[model samples]
Target chain A: MIEALFAAVLGGLLLLGLHRKVIARVQQRPGPPVWQEVLHTLKFSFKSTWVPETASPGLFVGIVLVAIGIWTAALAVVLAGGSILIIFGVYMLHKIVEHGFGLSSGSPYGKFGAVRSVISAASEIPLFVSVAAIAVFTGSLAISDIVAYQAVNGPLLIIAPPAAFAMYLVILSKMPFSPFAIVEGKELVSGYKTEHFGVWRAGLEVANAIKTSVLLGLFLLLFLGPLSPFAFVVAIVILLVSLSFVCAVTPMLAPFDSVTIQALVTVVMLGYLVLLGVIP
Target chain B: MSSLGGAPWYILEFGDELVYFTPYTTTLLILALVFTVLALVSRPERQVEALFGTDAIYAKDTTVDQMRFRRFMAIACGCASMGAVVTGDLFNFTLFVALVGITNVGIVAAVKNRHVQNAAFQYGLVALTATVPLFAGAGIVAATTGTLSIVALASGTVPQAPFFARALLCLGVVGEGMAPFYAAKAEMFRAPGAPYVIMCSLSSLLIFLRVAEVVMVI
Candidate 1:
């Protein structure tokens, strides 16, 4: 479990670096080294962390701890092959973390970001739909059971391609430069993250990296099933490259537009689910 | 048997029926307790100053009353959420759900802003209307199965309910402010105090979770 946590944190940072490089290449500009995120984290960790006078000190600290805790729990669940329902629950609870992160600071930008976060929660419905589709196909909600089912019946992607695609979009929203990055868009001056700095910002960055790894790992587990260590790394890299490509090409959507697109995707996924007989 | 590791711990007896503690309820109870403690210790965000002008005149005694009421509502909301989770009787569960609704409204009712009050009123209307289905579902189950005991239902002593009753029960809980109805409730969170406002969301979530279990079991 600890190894999985370490791998997720480190691999996630590397993936972020790769994503930045890919975006830079797409824009025809020089980019930082692939180790840039690692250096950024190290620098932030070494700096002095302070509470903003305008913020509630307790909630400011608590939100960061909650973010780290949730991501840690999420990685542990994936590594331990626990129930997927727990993962979905954790995903939903993340809304609270975002809300707390913004509200605790009492900044207008942070509050706007928090409101966007609430609006963006509509995206999670599609994830629940995807999970339900998988549950229907596997006859269980446990990650291990789903993996075992895939071993016998082959990858669920063949059976539920649209659900997989919908999940891909959901995962895409979590990555930087995606249309759904409204919460931390340039206009909001980094949105909910505007108030956090130094060590606290470092913690948020690390937690975010772990979250990225977990989402990709979960996608792999659900769609591709468990693979050998070599195959797993290859699959993760391939998915990251695809995500980077999407991030490079797509302009960020307006907040309402992002919600509309997700809602449409969810509607289409629900139609696919109906066709697959996952939903009646 | 006194207790089993994964089995429900029988806490009370009413003739052939039993009230018991299961892992599901225990987990929610612990969560409610933790949130309750946080509410007690956390400071208010003093949102009134932000929403209204500093020159805005407000009576000091009324502000004090609002704070006191908000605290009471927060604690009540937590207790109601805990009750909704821990109670083993289906009828009692419905009662706790109703209490949660009232207290959720209470939590934000003290906010001085007209928007907050109006939102609370809208939520209160929905919550009030939702009770018909909540109690009606319970009544239907009792009528069909001859028992309102969750243990009896889970143990298969009672007959499974028709689809309508289950659907109604789910609708009632969801109407208490899940996704579709969340718009009405979201405005309530705009009220200043974070600790107390959080209780509104927490109670709704806890009750919704408990209802899923209750619907599945009964």
Candidate 2:
């Protein structure tokens, strides 16, 4: 479990670096080194950290810890091959973390970010569709059981492409530079994270990296089936590259539009699930 | 009966009826307990100037009593949520849900802002009306199954409930601020305090979860 946590954090940072480089190349500019995020994390860790005078000191500090804790729990769940329902529950609980992050600071920017977080929370419902589809196909909600099913029946992506596509969009919404990034867009001066600085901000960044790794790892596990260590590394690289390309080409959507697009996708995914049931 | 450290593990009886506690209920109890402690330690954001006005703001300021009341309501919300999750009796679950709703209002009712007060009032109205279906559903279940005990329902000793009663139970839970009704409660979140305000959302969520479990088991 500790190794899984470490891998999620480190691998997530590396993936962020890779994303930066990929986006920079797309924009016809030289980006920072592939290890730039690693340096950024190290720098923030050593820097002095403090709670803003205007903020609720306890919640401000507690939220950062909660952010890290929830992501770590998500990673551990995935690594341990626990029930998917628990993973979904943890993912839903993240809305509280985001809400706490924004409201604890008492900044309008943070509050707006928090509101955006709430609005975008509707995006989580589509994930349920994916989980249901997988459960229908694999007959189990346990990650290990799903992996075992895939070993016999082949990758779920082959049987349920629409669900896989929905999961991909869910991952995109979480990644930087996507339309759903409106919560922390430039206009909000980093949104809910505006008040966090120094080591506290670093903690959030590390947590985000782990979250990225966990989501991608989950996507791979669900769609690509279980893989050898080398294959797993390759899968992560391929997934990150694809996500970077999408992030590079797309502009951030207005908050309302982002929610609309995700809601539309969710409706479509649900329709697909219904059709899957009707056809077979 | 099975026991955990000398305490009863499976059943808790009240008068002629009983409630069952399974591992799922235990898990949710632990979760509510953890969040309750988090609510206690976390500080409330004091941003009255931002919400109302910058001029002294003495009139609308939260009094010590109001703050204490909010704290009490938050603790009550947590306890009610734990009760809703752990109780094996359908009627007891409804009672806990109602307590959770009322305390959810209390958690934010102390805020002086018109908008916050209005939103809380609106939420209170919804919660008040929601009890109709909540209790009606439980009554319907008891009339049909001859008991309100979830253990009996789950053990297949009782007949399955009709769709109308199940839908009513779900309706009552959803009325407590899920989806369509959430808009009425969303503005209540603008209340200045983070810790107590969070309980408003957390309690509703926990009740919704417990309701789902109850509906499935019953």
Candidate 3:
């Protein structure tokens, strides 16, 4: 379990770095190496760190721990083949963690970021629609059950294309530099992360790494079902590269447009779900 | 929690309430506990605001009296969320969900900012109105299925809840402050208490998660 977690963190960082590289290459620029994020986490960790003067010191510090704690628990859930509802729950909680990151520091930029996080909360609804679609097809929320269903039937990707697309959009929204990531928009100076520096920021990086791994892994688990270890790596890389291409071609949307697009996608997904006769 | 080391698990049940933890509710309860402790220990941050035209920035302190009230509301919100997650009864779940919305408003209403006050008022209205559907959904389940017990409902012993009841329950949760129409809920985040303000979002998420599970089971 420990080794799996360590690999997940390192592998996830490399994937994120690769995501950056993919975007940079598509944009006609040389990007940092795939190990850059791993190094970035280390660099931040060794830097001097302290709670900000204007902050609630307890929450300022505690939220980072909570952020990491929740994701770590998420990793455990995925590994245990637990209910996918827990993964959805963790994704939602990550928003509050971002909000906490912004508001705990009392920085105007962070506050704006936190507010954007809340406003952009509408974008998360696609995830629920996708989950519902999956639950409809598989008739279960547990990961093991989902895998069993896929094995007996076929990949949900082929069976439920619209559901897959909805999920793809949901994952796209969370990938760094994706059009919908308004919470960390450049204008807010790293947005919710503006005020978290040094070790606190490093802790957050660890959490993000875990989150990236868990979400991507979950997508594979839900759509393609179980795979051998090597196949899992190959699958997630293909998945990440596809997501990167989407991120590369798109411009970060104005917040309202981002929310509107996600909402519309959710409505369309829900319509498909209705057609499935899962929803009434 | 079922097994400290992955042993085969048995669900632990409490007395007549039949309250129990599935892996889902256990996670929710842990989250509520974490944030409740955060509210208990964390002071509200002194919000820093800048004078728009100039370089001047000042930090506004949260008042003692307001802190006390928001803290109390935050804990109440947390407890409501915890209850919502663990309750085995649909009626109790609605009651707990309703308390979560009311306490969410209380958590921010004392901020003394006009923007926050206005938003909270609007949010409170929606939250209060949300209960009508919430209770009506539970009421319908009771009327149609002849029971409000989720355990019994999920047991497949009773008649299945109607499609409208399930839809109403979901709609009520969304109205309780789930997104796509959370304009007032977003505005209420402008309230200055980080720990307290967080419970508002957390409670909504918890209730939403719980409702999804409930709707599926029943």
Best by DockQ: 3
- Whole-model lDDT, model 2: 0.77
Clash totals for all candidate models: 0, 0, 0
lDDT of 3 at B126: 85
CA lDDT of each prediction against the hidden true structure: 0.76, 0.77, 0.87
lDDT, candidate 3, at B140: 96
User: Residue-wise lDDT of candidate 1 within B62-178, one digit each (tens)?
Assistant: 265777788888999999888887788888888889899899888988887899799889989989999999889989988998988777776776677766787788778876745
Q: Give per-residue CA lDDT, model 3, range A125-243, as digits (tens).
A: 88888888888887777788899999999899999998888888888888889999888999989999999999999999999999999989999999998799999999999999999
Q: Candidate 1 or 2, higher lDDT? A: 2
Computed on C-alphas against the true complex, the DockQ of each candidate is 0.22, 0.27, 0.52
True contacts kept of each: 0.05, 0.24, 0.63
Candidate by candidate, in order, the iRMS in Å equals: 5.0, 6.3, 4.0
Compare the candidates by TM-score and give the number of the best one.
3
lDDT of 1 by residue, A1-280 (tens): 7777888899999989988998888878898899899899999999988876556566778778878887898787777676665566566666667767776766667767776776676677688668767766786666888899999989988978877887898888888887788888989888878878899989988998898899988999999986998998899989988988888888999987888878888778868767877433
lDDT of 2 at B69: 86
Ranking by DockQ: 3, 2, 1
Q: Each model's TM-score, in the order given?
A: 0.85, 0.85, 0.96
TM-score of chain A of each: 0.97, 0.96, 0.98
